[model samples]
Target: MAAFDGSTDYDVTLEIPVSIGGLELPNRLYRAPLLEHAGDDDPVDRLLDELEPCAEAGVGLLMQGATPIRGREGRAAPGMTGFEDPDRVASMSRLTDRIDAHGSRIFAQLAHGGLRSMEVWHAGYRRRNPGLRQRVVSKPPLPLRLADRLGILSIDADPLSTDEVYELAADFGRAADRAAAAGYHGVHLAGATMGIFQQFLSPFYNRRDDEFGGALDDRLRFFEVVHEEIRARTDVPLVTKVPAETETPWFVRESIDAEEAIEACRRLAEIGYDAVVPVGSSPFWDHAIIRGEFGSRGFDDRVSRGFEAAFGGPWRRRLVELAARIDAATTPFEAAWNADLCRRVRAVVDVPVLCVGGIRGRSEADRLLGDACSMVGMARPFYAEPRLAARLLAESDATAVCESCNNCVPPQAVGEPGVCRTPAVLKQRGEFEKRGAYEREGGNRRRDSDGPKL
Candidate 1:
């Protein structure tokens, strides 16, 4: 990675075209993957409605949020499109076509949420569906076991055998093949965010002595095998999200640190991953990734209605809420939080390194593109302003209006679309109604008052 000497012009630096695995993007700005809860009813249309605006607004690359490679069994939440279904994959061509028409490349982000799946998190759902169990790389951790014992979280899981691991990797390959058939320009593996890949890589979860665990090289075998599987099935460019567990609970001594994560990124590059997005994350679901103060209404809604199934009883919900408040206090938002981690990863890997995390303005994006990374990405900001790329790409000093209050996050747990719930933001766009801006709506359609200009 070349160091910026503060002499290059920001506009020129950000506008320079970059290529990843023979796929060329028009500019260095990308929309990072954020789950679009496209419901089962016309899911393809809903996905297109959510993503096309970003492409039309001139985003260089768009990563469709974590799509389950398998059926409902691997889903992290409700309303995710099942790429494993051939019929569903075929319908996704319309989305790909529209995005391409805007000259923007879209990548299908394939993922399976291991222990983080609803089977482990949503207690009521687990109770209603007795057969559903979370698939894990190893046994459930102490906290999870305690939670289950205390009736806080009901969880049942089976550790994947070595053979089953290979089968799961094959599923990833099949998903990539489906993505290629659907006309996506590339594939992005959701390896971070405590997903299945992270379960294998992080010692906090991987407690096996087989070929797929123990040393760092062995722990990385699953990813290498998945990469091989994808390569065998499709020739599209592959990108992966790598988590640097830089922040973890005080008791967690086995988490992957920044150094190990950097090495992991280097290994992924060697394994032929076209690009790596190294992010600052924790072993647990907390504010480390989506950093910001919690919105009171959002938190209340999450506990009272949205995530009632996830947190279980009243006492358990209160415990989880306390934990979340503590997390927020400890992990406050910082703009360009991942820039240093990305810079470190870039120093070793020959492939493009993408940076994302609390980056909200042109100056931050420009500085990152100038020296730290090959591309800069923003996720939550896109939820606030779907057509954000127009201003980001065209203006010299544009900044997003999203306050990063995290008000839009909670509803997704219950199948709601990602939308701005902030009163001021909605009012500014003239979408706030008497029903309240945070009210659950049937669809993700923009109101008459909303447009690309916002």
Candidate 2:
């Protein structure tokens, strides 16, 4: 027998069929979960249009972006859908129908805002609840060790009450049922560190004396119950975006480093998760997820201006800018940034592992699928060009034109559908209207309320 040189199998590895639960994925390239803002956009028609190209491009697996479990409490952005809503189910059905036509397997990536809830920004939903960010944790829990306090882990956000935690678990289970009804092949829990699931799992933000708090087992108790409930409700595949490695050391250290993440993933896989998708700490280590030119935030011509406005003046404005700059500071753009992380994770779990980070084109995909991970997931590149996968598959030498500018991220960050700002997306009034801002043509006018929706 000949020695297996890595290059020989590169072409076929990504093309091979793999099974995710009962769902048979036709290829190794799954579209990373991303927001189409169909929840808030024209809901049905616009989502169909936005997803049409990706489907036509021939991706076999497409994970639709984050949908909140609770309509108001967990909404990270205004446009995010609560799949339970009748209008949303109809819309999801329409979009899923379009995807099925192209022989694609689609899943809804369900999320709960948890502590980072953008409920503060929701216009219709905001007035209903007392503002909770500061009040809930009016006193942010102090990190137990001096080492843990070194970075972004000091975030002072209120912890969910013991009841709220269990309620959230039930919400996720019911949400999964709704996702199945909406024509998705499976449901995904957004356990990435940025959202509530990770918040409950990480000690940095989850400081309470209740059963949901304390040791690692206690922190994960909420998730164990949620996982058990979701599995019982649906037989569809369940995937989770868990931390493989924390991006910046401070946030993912001690309790949940690379070793801890693997251990947790190993246990979760046993608990019934169909696959584990690994993510570096997001937002806090902004550049890790979306790398680009140094300090080049699209905020001035982008979404999130409303966030800046909340600061109210030059001092706060300067502070926000500095924070954004620090968070998004540049890292060298690389191919398959998370391949090694995925390789580490693939070693421990028996379930399929999906790796996504800094994957730009065919070459990177091949590099990643060559054994580092079972699948390669793409997000921003597709946002930059919907035909991204087709282009890569058609030409082995091809690469994405995305500058990795992170422009598309902010839109979905708040809950607006992605808008490619490269050649001026704002200039297209017809396209802009579907995204729910700009009442007229031309980029000349702006809406009375709401930041760019992300």
Per-model TM-score, in order, reads 0.91, 0.80
Tens digits of per-residue lDDT for model 2 on 219-308? 777668888888778888999988643555464443456676776777777777888887766423246555664434446444445443
Specify the highest-TM-score model's number: 1
Cα misplacement distance, residue 241 of candidate 2 (Å): 0.4
Tens digits of per-residue lDDT for model 1 on 1-454?
A: 3322323244445556777898878777899999998955568878888998788777889999999887767678877877888778878899999898878889999999888887788866676667766778999778768878877666677899999999999999998998899899999999999888888999998999899999888999999999999999999999999988999788787888999999999888988898999988998877899999875557665436656567776777777777777888888889889998988887787788899999999877888876678888999988887877777766778787788898877677777787888988765545422423323222122223222110
The regions of model 1 sitting more than 4 angstroms off are 1-12, 300-303, 429-454
- Residue pair clashes in candidate 1: none
Local error of candidate 2 at residue 159 (angstroms): 3.6
- Cα TM-score of candidate 1: 0.91
TM-score of candidate 2 relative to the true fold: 0.80
Worst 10 residues of 1 by lDDT: 445-454
lDDT of 1 at 414: 77
